[model samples]
Target chain A: MAPYETDDSTRAEDADDLRAGPRRSARYVVPVAVVGVAAATIGLVPALADSGNPDLPKITAQQLIEKIAKSDVQQMSGTVKITTDLGLPNLGGLQNSMASAAPRGGSGSSADPSSKLMELASGTHTVRVATDGQDRQKLSLVESAAEYSLIHDGKDVWGYDSASDQVFHSTAAQDGGKRHDPAPATPKDFADQALKAAGDTTSVTVGGTAQVAGRDAYKLVVKPKQSGSTVGAVTIAVDAKTGMPLKFTLTPASGGAAVVDAGFTKISYARPAASTFRFTPPKGAKVTEEKDGAHGDHRHPKGAGPSSHGLLPGMPGEKGAKGGRKVIGKGWNSIAVLDTGSKGGTPSASGAKGLGGMLGSLGDPVSGKFGKGTVFSTRLINALMMNDGKIYVGAVTKDALVKAADTGH
Target chain B: MSRADPETEGTARTARPAADTGPVTEPAGAGRAPSPLRTLGLLRSELSTTFRRWRTLALLAVLAAVPVLVGIAVRIQTGDGQQSGRGGGGGPAFLTQVTHNGLFLVFTALAATLPFFLPLAVGVVAGDAVAGEANAGTLRYLLVAPAGRTRLLVVKYATTTAFCLVATLVVALSALAVGALLFPLGDLMTISGTRITFADGLGRALLIALAVAVSLTGLAALGLFVSTLTNSGVAAMATTVGLLITVQITDQLPQLHAIQPYLFPHYWLSFADLMRDPVYWDDLVKNLQLQALYAAVFGSAAWARFTTKDVTA
Candidate 1:
């Protein structure tokens, strides 16, 4: 160590010389080194945390499918994180438009199950889900400061929004406990959708093993054989022990980030407390009860429940369209054409107008033998809403949507 | 200006005698390993000096008043019976709940201020930590008091961190008071729509406040580094605050989403997770880790600059 200098002028000169020397430059090396270490840690931690693919006993795709079908481990609770990147521009603006255009009286309220489904279409959502048996379940959409919870306990279904202090409740008609409102899609629900599509039109292959939510899992990769499908492949991580799907990822043909990725960050096979499914409206909460069969018609204006695809409702081969809804083409290339105002009542008519306006602003105008319409295209789904009140929607290109419309199915 | 030379030289010579006498005579113990007791005394004095300033008090007072304003405004809005239409569609998180339970004001205020007000106050105090002393020419006297540069820098950072805690508590306590006074307090609702007892709500509020204070420590360290870079207190403060605003704006821009998570302010609102029924540790842990990273990087930079540079002031 250098001796302390008493003379001011000499010490000042020494300071200036030090500033010009290598020692001054060397002093900065510590912070630079720290930053370098931080960057390295940031890059390495995720890589290390991944721990690569877990090794498991090889199983055929058919065997894995059978495993999922036969394995019955019910009553579980977990935190599911769902991320959707559909290449939509300005999602905040889109949400604002949807909120403003949403009908206040009927199915557009914040507590409405369908509106809740709309909220899940974009951005990342954390959902706390607990299910006990087939009839009782709970799903809570956790936001930063607010929560929307849907609790189904036997015949009674309750939806509560903490922020609004509003509750939507309905009693299931005694027709063997059929739930009208769709629960938020868990990995299991998405896996079911992917597996349902795994027929002759798709090739199911075992893609090795994975560790999901700290559990050993087998990865099932399902790829569409038809080139017309926008979905390149769907991968589901099935728990080796329980056969429950722990993660579901859908990659687009264009190939960037997965368009739909739903995975459990934490899970427990232990049955959730029965009290978790029970709900009583808080004091001062505005409770609205839906009459039997009324919620189903207005809530699902497109005649398809959110459970059909877990994201965009009425995807290819969705059943239960009552009237004016037709499926054109076959398998992955199929397009669903709906006559919006035909049997949808006044609320649906108004909703279609607002939706048409919103989609018109978001999409590009196209014209062909199908006449003029706005073609709203995402990475995976293209929706062409014609001026004649018919909507042609499918997981295909804009040209395919136009061709589907021209077929006039 | 001409007398500065002799004055600095005189202080330097005087400091040597103090160093020879050891830790017994000087609290800062120049030229020797700093004693823990005297270092604590130095820290105490530094904290007193920082908190006693009218500027600090004014910043705190402003922070304390924000929750009151928000609470009263919300009270007035709900009093009009027009809240039904608005629901929880807009505004900061937990704003809608303040009308039902006053305890929510704490969460609302913290969320309201975490992005800007709280960090701005932290910037002001931290940016002035060392630069203000130098600008007043008290730094030379303190150093000549045989306060080693490293110890002084450490004391300065400690003082800034104390301010961060004090500032956050001021906001939280004020919100709690205003909330209790304005709205009915009872069982609180978690973000998961589950009910929690009032005592549990109060405990969570404290944890949230602590989390908020922890979040600002990174910015405090960055500000302290900026303070060491210049002798002008106002310049340092301005630069720190300006950097804060720029980072916040960049964090919000969609184009910069790739780099937004790396920014210090990115996960500050993860404090809201404490209000969840089963607290989500993912973002909260990330926030803590990110703050630790920033603190380490900037803290070392401040130490390097303060120790190596000549303190002619």
Candidate 2:
């Protein structure tokens, strides 16, 4: 005890006396109680907050799917953020190969899209989009203040990049006025992709309501029945009032966090002004005119399933696009398998052996019901390269892919 | 003063009073000690004493200057119309847009400092809380005052917490000023991909700053416990900062993923979730709860050690 603590000396004696008895134990009761309550609440809050959706009316999976399929809310404009987290090493050589494989000299694809070869090319990008009906639309990818935008009015399409000071122009033949078909695929057409043929491989369920893009949304969860797939589940948040899809998340089958998340942070149903679709090339900008077939439309045959190509479409004679690719299964669990040897040539100087060795070394080799394959995964997309030349790719789990390979052939 | 009050200890003392024990001039009450008002006075003095030190002032000055330096450097890098390269570095990607909307500077500065500088500053202050006083031989006089050990410990912690708020606010305010000076302030896009009004954006920035401060609570308590372990302020500060860096490195190791969630800095970056539209609350809620868990565990440990600690310099 300090000499100056004259007053505390006496109290210290009392504390000592209390310390020898139940009074000392009493000091701990309050703190212990508080900790207990806190621990209990911590354990309970997330679970409680996760379970209920008071605003959403109960509906069967079939009815909800029907509602989603029939939703016709068009002429909406909003900003969307796309994040892809594929857990793969940064391979500069792979990026170079992918970039050189594109036809238009790597002009207006995406930022280092050569790098986008692996969904493991993890990044978050912002796209601002406006669509009036479908034929007239404009979408811009904003990087800082610079914008890479694509504008299509009727058959004329222009892609402008402010940073590169370049514009790409192409024209598509107009559809016969008498024909009746679904609108041309707009830039923000994820809802259509998510709801497409979901009944095949997915077991649909209604989840709790959430507020997305400042609107009330009901969750529509599509869970894959196949066990081998890496995709745990696909969740879509549909606007309760307008029936428009506002958010889509794909959680990997072996979940840690969402692999791919695409959603509107803000949205408005009101049609964008007519001027939003117009673009005038700035002075001194370089202009490139591309042939009609260069716009990727030639790859999607009429009545054919969605193109099985990666985000960056393969150009003519490009080894990637030349590979014979086939889809196995259907819906969210579907796997796209490609015979990479079909190009009848080895990859750049790296050679098929080097590329194969590199990819194999980068990915984990797993032998399962589907035999041996090397799996490269991120949060969203998983690529399984078999010992043979066949490559299986999907958002499904590893086992699901193996099963698909076993049954797919 | 008579010793009839049950609250006063009944122990006997044999040592004589030490000299130069300033601030003990207040006369002892009859059978009572200092009033609540005087205890509050102790808190005020504690805060002033902590904040007024040259080291503390230097820490705050560095924190305040970080935003200005960042803002100026970004302004120069982007230069009027040149498309800024993708927001470089590990900070939130939106930091690149600071040139377009200065308001983002607040977020940028926070993100820039949270990983090392800010936490380092916090570790320094918290590490010195008790050990510094004891090192300077003032702790004996403080404990000798009517302020009991438990009460004084609480005051020391409260003062450190108050420093947390001041330090965060200084960074934010400096960034706000520098942002307004260097770039346009208007509706800004959020991480959720939605546009929010400038006013609302500012409000969110404030919330983010608060969250950033709160994120350090667990570390603050941890440092308090370390401070109680030694009489040398330097050792306490070093150990606290060593723990922080080690945990940060360990959190990144893939093999340690199972234990990373329990780390204090694991969710420190969760403040980015606030910038999203509809305001993602799950990680934010988890962060607060984790901080609470840390506070409870380490705070109790600090109390248990500090209460019975011998004050000898």
Candidate 3:
């Protein structure tokens, strides 16, 4: 100990050096910390500003709804990104089924039925949507160089996929008669659909303000009141200035990410370029003319989820033809029960026969509040096969489908 | 010879005529080697050492050849000019449009290479930078050149960075040349569904190239730090590339998504935003910011290790 001990002078000098080491290193540490913090702050600015919007005017749910209902915003264009995460295995077959079941030659499902159906089946997708008059609008899914576009110009609707070099044209029949025009399945249209169905089924409340598409928006949350449905809530971001619904997100009662997160990433009130509404198939493109009747009659009720088939007159099984769909419930949580079975409609018309016994013979039987039923679930669509032979399906949860089955008749 | 050495050593020892005369003045020449490094001299030396190697040349050649092969394949596929939209195929979806407008070839080439090839090249260059010199026993001499450890490391990093810019530009330029030779170059349609004049498109292409080059800065710094860890250049190169692929694979996994944003390659595709009509800058800005974060963290780590490291190799 005596040999190891340094003299008082030397010991003090060593102590000084030890203290100075950290003090000197503090110079670098301080700048690094400051720069790191600065970089992080800059990186987080967008998210923070997005999450903490201060200037938005607070309003009640009713006032927001009234504002949305009365607001008029036509001929607007923006980039909309849609993401669907249905907790299902493979979405490929489901996408095909949805694409087939979806109204043809429309933007209801996506701009490109085949491609966008596959693209949005799992992950995120960006599409450009623009609407001019009641009779004119365009939805273009932008690919790298190739684009798929569906343009409705007054008298004619066109579906053009540049990648596949195919064009689908459908002409509206001009009967000297007034007819109800099915609104394009845009975010606004979807929001309006949900809002219309918010009667006894949902509890509407005003949520905190959020910044959506660089605009101040008041959040309107609509939660289904009845536990009969598996719907957790439907959140719509109503633009404060324009009163237009800028974003619509639906989360199932069986929670995960939002099932449908369709929103405008960028939006503008200015009129879209007129040329966007017009489409002439490029030279050498294969053209196919589709009869208007195939998709003309079906109107996707506003809140009918992503797939609405109220217009399909006959059930698939009932007529031995491919077209038939039964929609249960109303509003943003409606489920369309489609019978994709090769045979015409289900064997039992009335659901009096316990579906559990019949569906047990078909699909894998899964039991819940809806009683015994064969359950087939996808990330985006859930189907409950009842013994009554009705396959209840929608973007809602299993419970919602069960409730629909109980009340669908 | 011994008497001759002393005679010459006497002049070398007397050269300074200072209190500290060396015993072996002829060979020590410690005072003679402390020449102040000029910035241009440092850059020239770095460029020569890096580019003169066969490995570096091979990487560049491979990079340049990619666009050429892509251009030829595109030309062959669409010779009749009746091709439909791009299909699920090799290269980017933009490659399908090269027949219509050759200028898209540049974009196609960039998209094709950015995922792996470009980053791999950058990793190789940066990984070999400091470690290779150390392995070759040239690091001690380089440090002795009065450049200081910090300055020498800076030069090495700067050289690797220059290679990044060059590698990206090479792919772009070769695509441009092949594109111009094969297809007509004119006004281009942007991904955001907007039309841009040929001149403006060229400007955007250049910016995209710059963005892509800057995107690799994080990887460059990471590889540089890895290089500082060992004396084996090959080992460093392999480790850096392996880490690059691992980070990339991790980024793709949905389970590890919470940490994906911090990964180096997370924002590589943000350059596509530049091709949009109004240009979406959110992800692009984040990409730049993230890269800067990586550079700062890893660059500081490299400096700390390098300054304290004993040059045993």
Candidate 4:
């Protein structure tokens, strides 16, 4: 006990002496300073990367639109990152349930180009895109341990899924070169869509100059004039020198964050190697050759079941609605109403029952002048599926969808 | 000092001579920095001591067995002819391809173990690096042996890093061997669906293994920093493992996506990008940069803590 007391007193004295030495304290200060510097650097880097919005020549929105329209700098390759947060419930779990509910050997479930497109509707995805011209382009959706590549070389279009080792091949004449449905939505695609949406219903103005993919660009902000539209604004960063859309962002009216943001992280305008567009089905891969105009049929091998249409199983007003689809309004406030023929008690009415059940779980039941139905709402789009087999879908609020449904009915 | 009295008395018989000898041999230059050659020798000794432990061998054995177990399981599953229509099904990445080409087993096993097992093993080794020496009362002796604190810390870190490489290689080589034995090896189908020769595949596998080892270096430094904060080896190990799991969980949460990129484990799976035909280097570069940041930050922190730390233990 005496020895322990003496040892405790000595340890206290030693600690005091150690603390008293300024040089010893300085030794400790080095690490603390290192940590401080590291923290500062970590915090500083991203801020610095985004710090100075590059100064560039100002251009009007009209000139920018004309420039994008006339820009023909085709031969290029780049990496695009797309992030979409529609405030939907975990779509991964929902996709699993839908896949399970889909029938075995169902074309709508998996291994199809449309199913791959459905994967891009949520979360973040990295896409590698190379375009030699209109007829020769390659887009690869880069997954963690797999890739889904859609290569369009002249007349031949090939879609390859590495994980499944499946190849989907089609000719340009057969599918009108539109079989690249699995390709991720690039900034150019979104920018084109947003530009088309610009009209009397939208106010297009040049916002500011910024840097995107290390290229100075001018921001073209497009805001819908209608109050019912769910979209707050669409901002496209057009490369100042080339007029190429380097970034596209779509924010919701009640946005905390953009619902859809896609931009090139790296870009090169140089012509891609010819080999980039060439694709051959690897050995052991199952190759499916799509016939003329049969892409729709091939995608929905199990007949024209209503649920088997669109990128998702039950998404309304997509392809295959054909003649029954009608636009209820123009521009941003427009709603598409699809007559699914379920109300007439057609033989294929039971086909949508499975999809209806799934939608029932995802959507909330609502009643209006159009009668009882389910309303599925996302951050930027609201879809109201009527009990009478009508689907009202638009980038609008739930009230707008309900109102559109009532008026159309 | 009173603390020195007990330490001297406790190890008095042996420690007195060692303490006296350090000054007697280099009387005028006792405080001078250790030569690089001496530091190299100390590093060699530290590596030998660490690898000689039965626990390290057991951890390595467990890591080696992971690939064997994975390969055998895959072999049995496919042998039953039940593998049809199972492509792209949910499992470890590259797992479904293992049956087609044996080389894929290396990738599958690494992916399966990387998220947890490999890092867990590293955490154990690095967590015990300094604290274990202190717990065994060898830290005071090592320091008094005139092994400067900075030099000892550097050696300890290097040894832990060596363990990381060894553990990762054990898993890779074992996987390669098992993969060769259980399945046919041939042209490898990359993530881009392009075929590369077996040699190229093997080269990529080696690169992937190296990337995985480099990934754990960050965690090793982190564990070493935690070790310097405590004298209890078990406490340090538990704390490191706990931090690893917490960070992993945080990385998974969608709400924390803003900060996930800064976490060590966030980009661990980016090694798979190497399997791409064109080889996407974006995420891989981010991972390497993040790891280097962690190493520099934590390595300096460990050095500082160890240098000024009281050697009461």
Candidate 5:
């Protein structure tokens, strides 16, 4: 309501100033905008660079296998150490243990379940068990180091090494004193393959990963279709990131059955240098050189598994619980645990009748040894807690294992 | 010769001091204590001026980027399994190749040993330091100031050191950044076959940085000495670079193995030896002592020559 008045000159000047304001700001505004755009562009350089490489290098299991197949490798060998978390087939009910538990009967059973049997990890061990189903007279292979391997054959036993010039036949003959071989693979192969088997990726699952030589591992489970074999079902743990297998375990179908497992420690992916693979026979070591191809013959018997699958042969028995402490054997002290009863509720062959039933019974022709106490004849690989209460007996066979139940000779 | 400042270092900078005519006169009613050791202050100003020199700043920036380039090279070359160490006999540990830094290739194990890349670069940058000023004719102008010749040398050396530290820091930080971005900042598998976690690796890297500084001090001093020896900036640079290269080459030959221990860069990377599980200290101490001795000798020689020599140039 005041004077709606303005001097024409002043109005014109005010209008002119308004027009000039934007023009003046445009100079700085455009430049600032350009600078901001430039800064943003510079910021995007890393992003652009990353986008150019959309696929991160992803190495997978298939790729690993392919690489292995493609590698120009000649041969590989080294010192391999194996640690087992699982026990034997007859000892299926045994727990995954750092050490074995005590026996049960005066026979070979222990009074203390927490006490241990002979630990496989006692010392340096290298064993070779091989098989080839051929000549019954072929020398059975029992050497510790595996060169003539039969693991890939996927069978139970092998022939002898008697005629093979590759290794000495004396030790081979002493092992196989019998004229026949068992099946495709033998004990020598198992001992050797066990270490390598531990590194095979059998199955994969998401689980607690372990550090095998500082590499992350993924769990693998491999189960066999049947039993009576060194490997009924192997559960393996592999490195998820590296696709390298780390640990392997063989579990029997029955709980408390034998559990054989192998764990690798301080593994390295490096191949040995050229000189490492070459080996020259040392002085006095008995070996017959075959002029040709990996010379040897191995055979196996018709059986569920290898002949040496259960235990060593030629053993003595029937010593009471408190007796038989002397380690009179070729390979130092040995202890063997056997399964008398079956988890399937059936009796195994050569079944030693339950001790409780024979406590009072007189000597029966078929059932009882009639208070029979025989001097342990073979090696000391078996023992049990008896009615007499003691530790290991020097029983080397299943019968000897039963004989170890009584110590009151 | 000018009077020595007992308060500061006896041998300061790479130039000669003025003739010792008299002592500092307690100025008229000078009550304020000579401004709390202007060493750090003048050092700061010298740095600002050095950076203002486009040539110096560009050279420094390029040198800083060398590590990143090295990282790129490494990213391109590694394989599935280590090939260098493993073969028919020797195992995988033998196959480990050197790290990706190209400067390392030229310098031998210096990168692995002392992490000396930064220091070497620093010496080159700093060697022509005073000579550059002399060529610019700014040396006399600065000497005539009330601060004095010895003070000017101190300032120059201070500036050179600052540049050395900055340049080394730049390269190290850039290397760390590039390593972080380009490679996994996880555990390191040490050449000695030990596994080091990221934290441990980081600690080792920092120690390497310190070792690099120690190693570079000798070179920086040597450069300053060379700079003092001549008024030509190029000659000073060539002399320092030539010395660095010669010592590096000799360190590699097996026949020179015995004599290698005497070379400065020979122990340049002795810092890496610190990565051992228990950390071997004897070699590290020796390396530090030798480097310090080099710095002292070069520094003293430069001072002695500068004080007596005529500046006809």
Candidate 6:
């Protein structure tokens, strides 16, 4: 009805109303049909892949180590941007990027441990730390957690919470793995749990090349041998030649993209103290006093059944029986994460709580209290021999534990 | 120039029924049919005109784009304990926490739009509601006929409401599209750590959209009120736009935080709280009530103003 529009229409010779017939239907129909067909193909990609082998790779401990030692250095250590998605007491989860982001202290435990606890009178407790030194892990100790130091000159592994100035000590022996502490439980945990677990030569295949940290990096895919959630396939950037891991990436087995990157800064390769490698408690530390007894003296609790191998009711029976002496039984209270094959994760105040929760939920370490501690009990199997094997671990005390290790029964 | 040759018409030959006329029963099929609904019909026509313009179409297209972008953003966010360049740390737990904080985004978007852009778009439609008729010289003819001020006010409100609906839909759809693409679609973990599935997500999105629609009611009523205040389309638009910004600035000041929640647009975003595992219906109900109260008060004022105002322009 605008004057100019009407005038333009009049000047067009008003050609036989091209939109008057069947052509009108065809005009809109053809474009819509073409678009619909194109869209269908784009949605079919995931369905097209063969269900079984998605060309996944396998990883091993040694392989994990070599991948990290790529850039051999004498000294390195720095702040690592760490985020543990499966939320712990103070951890983040799938929505991490969108919400409260907490920075932690990992003197070398995980940021937030699965479980951590301690009794002050005994100064004996367990803890986990972040792979990086960032997270607060204190709940596990009794008295001065003040001596918390993974690189102990002669002390129990512990960390200092500067905010509260509380010194927390770990109960578990500082094994070379991350525990329920933000600080490194041991150098090995930081180097191996992720770097070592993922750092591999044979296990990692070069996917392609890309730039990472402003340096040339190789896109290497590191797949967990048994993929499917609990243990998932991950990818990392490796310095092609030196094999130094530059960045770590994770892609959940269940579909969804957006691989998060955790970059490492300031690292050290200096040899840990001679005392750190040795497991010896400090003087006056009231650790468990082991009684002297022959390995053969220890035995399984009376009336214990084969199904008692510390497995969730539905889980498979111990692979230990086959190896006879194999220590292959599941740790009901010990969620032996295959990801790191280390004890329930880094120990912190709640490290024990975290692993215990996961284990309690996933396995069968039905809750019970032992002493003042919430002791999550499960069958402990004897060391399973790779060659000639026998099974005998659940017994009374340490002598039997050693004898069982040597005698295999 | 025949009968239409009126570049310089004789002193008194016009379309009016001389001096005193009841209603000119113009013949149909003769010309433009007297714009059918008369005053109300003209108001309706005035609103649709904005949608026909390129800027409105462009806004709609932009609205459609939000969903995809949101999806992408959710997908690429960092999940590990730490975040990298240009991104925040993200994870399953964090995602749930953010959902609990849903109302924040709603309030932010509402406040953001009221400032310059959204109100401008609204004014483009509302300002034109009356001044446009005058500009087109349709007002003189309309007043000479049956269109009284009452019918005109109602028609203008209806058209403005329609534009508001379309704009709100644009914002909601865009947010949803982006959220779906960026985040996992199956389940949403809540701040409390409980998991709610997509069924809940979809349901929540709907409530949120409705809440957004509710928020717009205030703006719509404001637009209509402004439209009735002046005959100039641009002036009415500037006035409303200025008021929106002033309110937004005041709402953000820490000193004003205590009373901010009482503002009409304050509770509009509470709809997002619906997506939480234990959906906080309390805030949502409060939001709706507040918005309703705002709409009622503003609508009444607009109604009164338009009904009493002289339309000599």
The candidate maximizing DockQ is 1
Per residue, candidate 5 scores C-alpha lDDT tens digits across A1-409 of: 0121332222222233344555433333433554465457547975664342122244454443333234332222222233333321232222222112111211111111111112232222322221122211111111211112111112112211111112222122333333322221222223223323222222223333445434555444333222222233445455445454445544544444334444443444443333221122212212332222212221211111111222221111211111213323221112323233322111111122222233223222221232432222111122332322222333234343344333223
Please give, for residues A116-144, the per-residue lDDT of candidate 2 as tens digits.
22222246676666778757766666553
Once model 5 is optimally superposed onto the true structure by TM-score, how far is the C-alpha of residue B231 displaced, in angstroms? 1.3
Measured with DockQ on alpha carbons, how good is candidate 4? Answer: 0.33
Q: Could you estimate the TM-score for every candidate?
A: 0.88, 0.63, 0.75, 0.84, 0.38, 0.37
DockQ of each: 0.36, 0.12, 0.15, 0.33, 0.02, 0.03
Model 4 lDDT tens row, B1-313: 2322312122242232234323333453445443556677888999999999999999999999999999998888778655436655677888867877888989999999999999999999999999988999888767655444666787899999999999999999999999999988988777775667899999999999999999999999999999999999999999999999999999999899999999999899999999987789988999998898889888978876776678787
Candidate 1: residue B123 Cα off by (Å)? 1.2
**Model 4 chain A: which ten-residue window has the lowest total lDDT?**
A311-320
Model 1, stretches more than 4 Å misplaced?
A: A1-21, A89-95, A103-108, A173-184, A273-275, A297-323, A340-375, A384-389, A398-409, B1-34, B80-85
In candidate 4, position A349 carries an lDDT of: 35
What's model 6's lDDT at A136?
A: 16
What DockQ does predicted model 5 obtain?
Answer: 0.02
Q: Native contacts recovered by candidate 5, as a share?
A: 0.00
Ranking by lDDT: 1, 4, 3, 2, 5, 6
lDDT string for model 3 (B242-272, tens) is 9999998999998899888889889888887
For candidate 4, lDDT tens digit of each residue in A269-350? 9998776676766555567765456454434323222322331222122322434456677667777666675452321233
State, as a TM-score between 0 and 1, how close model 4 is to the true structure: 0.84
Full candidate order by TM-score, most accurate first: 1, 4, 3, 2, 5, 6
How far does residue B78 in candidate 4 sit from its true spot (Å)?
Answer: 3.0
lDDT of 1 by residue, A1-409 (tens): 1243342332433354375577665667777998999899889998898997887888999999999998786688999999988776554664565554553544445676655655676778988888788798788898766778888889888888877767888776667875554733688877876777766888899999989999999999988888777888889999998899999998988899998899999999898876577676766667777755666553443312112233644234343243456677776777766677575443333444555664567789999997898887777777788887877777877887887788783
Clash number for each model: 0, 22, 13, 0, 90, 117
Residue ranges of candidate 3 with Cα displaced over 4 Å: A1-47, A50-62, A75-79, A90-111, A114-122, A128-186, A200-203, A225-227, A254-257, A270-373, A377-382, A393-409, B1-37, B84-86
Q: Which stretches of candidate 2 lie above 4 Å from their native place?
A: A1-5, A9-18, A21-39, A46-65, A72-357, A360-409, B1-27, B30-35, B75-95, B101-103, B174-205, B273-282
